[model samples]
Target chain A: DAGVTQSPTHLIKTRGQQVTLRCSPKSGHDTVSWYQQALGQGPQFIFQYYEEEERQRGNFPDRFSGHQFPNYSSELNVNALLLGDSALYLCASSLVYDTQYFGPGTRLTVL
Target chain B: DQQVKQNSPSLSVQEGRISILNCDYTNSMFDYFLWYKKYPAEGPTFLISISSIKDKNEDGRFTVFLNKSAKHLSLHIVPSQPGDSAVYFCAVFVQGAQKLVFGQGTRLTINP
Candidate 1:
């Protein structure tokens, strides 16, 4: 009955550091998608995971990557972070693809 | 290039009035469209959606109208309430693609 859940509601990291954010999909959901929302902007798609494999990716750079576990939980990893990397990272879960239920998101601030 | 666009950054409407948020897309391949509402410090929540085959879909006070020919869609909230104030985003799903393209969101303010 629980919706999508994300860990480390807020985080602060320095430039060039790596950070991993976690997400647990809603019950009965098999697909997980990651998105980034900068201040005053809409959420941008990063990638999507299904069947424990990445199925689709957005225009993001190689620094942004993600993984989906067998339990349908997901992790978004960002390496060599820059100041522009500071934003709200949102995780969404769905049965298929388009219809998504989102989590509260993890706010990452890169200094 | 931004495929999805919500040109109006903000909109203000009086309580009990109607609020119409508009969105446009440049891609004709988009088959499914959705609207999401978000509050500060929180992720977006699904509001309403429409597929390419349909021109309109409604849920209570919220209605989404799609004009495929124009590659445009609009969300209308009738008798808007103060609680309706939030940032609304328009999203498009490309056929056969699992990813969604999002617009720059419109901040709606319902004044009482």
Candidate 2:
């Protein structure tokens, strides 16, 4: 059984540009959630996707969005990236709000 | 505002001893609590969890204790080893919500 997996171990983007990070949830999982971990900080919930629709969101702004496909894979998109956007983006998968399994995460560097 | 808080930023304990890390929460509505361990440049791995209805949950070398009256919880590791050193995060799950609120994490170091 493969665990949650994320693409592009690391990424670099310039200000005002857009970037998309991908995630494949663990096998037998259906829900996907995204989180952001800044330097010296804990991971903060960005949003959660279930049934191909965003179910709940955190304090993030509209610029942060996500999508879930039928296969339970997910993608996080950040538009008009700012310097503060630089952080480790983590993806977690679960079965209907149960215990979550996290991925290695994609490190986004906004220059 | 941070619902969960780990007051101690770091702790050092001698190997083979017990290491106790504490966490406090301000939200009474949080029904589930969890502890996650993270290594450098890696996502956090779930350690243990306790539901509001239970006061304690144990798994192998890890034990999580909850005091709902005080809104406090703790993770205790017995016979701490050097490999146990890592940043530990305490998280809470609100009822009817899929989101988890995390603390600023506590870095644990076990000296040999």
Q: Give the top-scoring candidate (DockQ).
A: 2
- For residues B1-112, could you state the per-residue lDDT of candidate 1 as single tens digits? 9899999999999999999999999988888999999988788999999999999999999999999999999999998999999999999977566877789999999999
Q: Go through the candidates in order and give each one's C-alpha lDDT.
A: 0.93, 0.94
Q: Which residue window of length 10 is worst by lDDT in model 2 chain A? A: A93-102
Given the true complex, what DockQ would model 2 score?
A: 0.80
Worst 10 residues of 2 chain B by lDDT: B92-101
- Candidate 2 lDDT (Cα, whole model)? 0.94
What is candidate 1's lDDT per residue for A1-111, written digit by digit as tens?
898999999999999999999999999999999999999888888999999999989889999998999899999999999999999999999988548999999999999
lDDT of 2 by residue, A14-95 (tens): 9999999999999999999999999989899999999999999988999999999999999999999999999999999999
Residue A72 lDDT (model 1): 91
For each candidate, what's the DockQ?
0.79, 0.80
In order, what is each prediction's RMSD in angstroms?
1.0, 0.8
Q: Estimate each model's TM-score.
A: 0.97, 0.98
